[model samples]
Target: MQPPTLSLIGTTPRMRWAWTAAGVLLIAGWVHRPASAQEPAIFRGADLKLGEELIAQHRCAQCHAEKVGGDGSAIYRPLGVINNAGLLRGMVEQCNATLNFQMFPEEVTAVAAVLNRDHYRFKD
Candidate 1:
């Protein structure tokens, strides 16, 4: 037996277009799902630009450079003691407290999210 073609199945042009559109939508949703799922809830909708600006304003790199040398990114130990996303956020909050940055909770979360995106890459 042979399979039926679109012509044999009476598929109109409009129906073909609808099927194509539905497939595209499904693919699009699938493609974007993993990224959102991987992102931590605390980091969702985080202001990356604000985080970057805050890092600069605080001279975090300069201080880290003074402490650890190089461009200061070396201070970020993605595989080191600060292992998980919660720990990463806690470390950022600890830094804020110790440095008297007085950052709000959301700001701390934003900074941690930026660090995760750039370095740590914790899926959860």
Candidate 2:
């Protein structure tokens, strides 16, 4: 008493091609999506490599180590004041201004993005 089952076994070659094309399109859409599409809106298109370089050039970890001791990674408290992408970016901007790093807005965003990827993991 099994119900009728739909099967592609006897389908036309054209129908098979259409199904293949649809699957390809779906996979391509997912694969070719912009990297920013997966990141927080504020950090969209931020250059992570530049951010890493800036962090080293500015000795940010060294400064943080001086402030909080250890490797300075402790300064990045995911459960502390910075709880979102926007706040994380603002904190980087604050550092830029306070330390007179002279970083552009995009640079600040880049730094914040690296931090988010490494620590905060903020989706929004």
Candidate 3:
């Protein structure tokens, strides 16, 4: 026989209908996609390898996938609000703040640079 389902706090019943409703609400909150790459010289000095390592260590895709589905890449709207190098850096800062990543300035920049190379493709 199957075991009983746990609740959100581990003290209540696991309602099938409740989970479905939550999922529906999530699908209704999609954000806009940003412009991919096309940045200027500010990105010229970025370290691609370091950026890639930081992203892997932080598991950015894991979190994104959990929220937006499809391997989590859909959450990163390359052609959305982050149109330039400065904006890209700022977005990374926002993510760090929101998620309490506690990364230093260089680490944040590295992560963003890597993301730009692989996904954003912003020129610099």
Candidate 4:
């Protein structure tokens, strides 16, 4: 038996043009889609490894545990006031300033990015 194939027989030029246009549009949409759709724009190109290291170095979990009374994981609330990526970064910056961490802007972004990856999962 022969494999089935699409038959263009008797198809009008307008119909063919419509199909071609639809295909082009579909392909263009896919091709033009943002590559970092899975990651927030603020955290793009952030150093996740450095973020992890800084988190550990800063004893963030220990501090959180002291404040919240637990493993410190409760400090991260995905649906809380810090819901979006920008807000999340802002929160990190606030912490850096309040704690006198003296972290650079990129370092703050890196920390926020790691927190987003592990806890918040904010994309955008």
For lDDT, the strongest prediction is 4
TM-score for each of the candidates: 0.75, 0.73, 0.62, 0.72
Clash count, one per candidate: 0, 0, 15, 0
Indicate the TM-score of model 3.
0.62
lDDT of 4 by residue, 3-117 (tens): 3444433256877788888999999999999957889988989999999999999999999999898899899999999999999999999999999999999999999999999
Instruction: Give one digit per residue, the lDDT tens place, for model 3 in 5-121.
Output: 544424434566667668777776543222223445565566768778878888888989899987887876778988766788899999899989898888788888777777777
**Preferred candidate (lDDT higher): 1 or 4:** 4
**Cα error of candidate 3 at position 122, Å:** 1.9
Write the number of the candidate with greater lDDT, choosing between 2 and 3.
Answer: 2
Q: Would you list the rank order by lDDT, best first?
A: 4, 1, 2, 3
Give stretches of model 3 more than 4 Å off: 1-39
Worst 10-residue lDDT window, candidate 3 = 30-39
TM-score of 1: 0.75
State residue 92's C-alpha deviation in candidate 4, in Å.
0.7
lDDT of 1 by residue, 16-59 (tens): 88888999999999887865567877788999999998999999
Q: lDDT values of the candidates?
A: 0.89, 0.89, 0.74, 0.90
RMSD of candidates 1 onward, in order: 5.4, 5.8, 18.1, 3.9
Candidate 2 has a TM-score of: 0.73
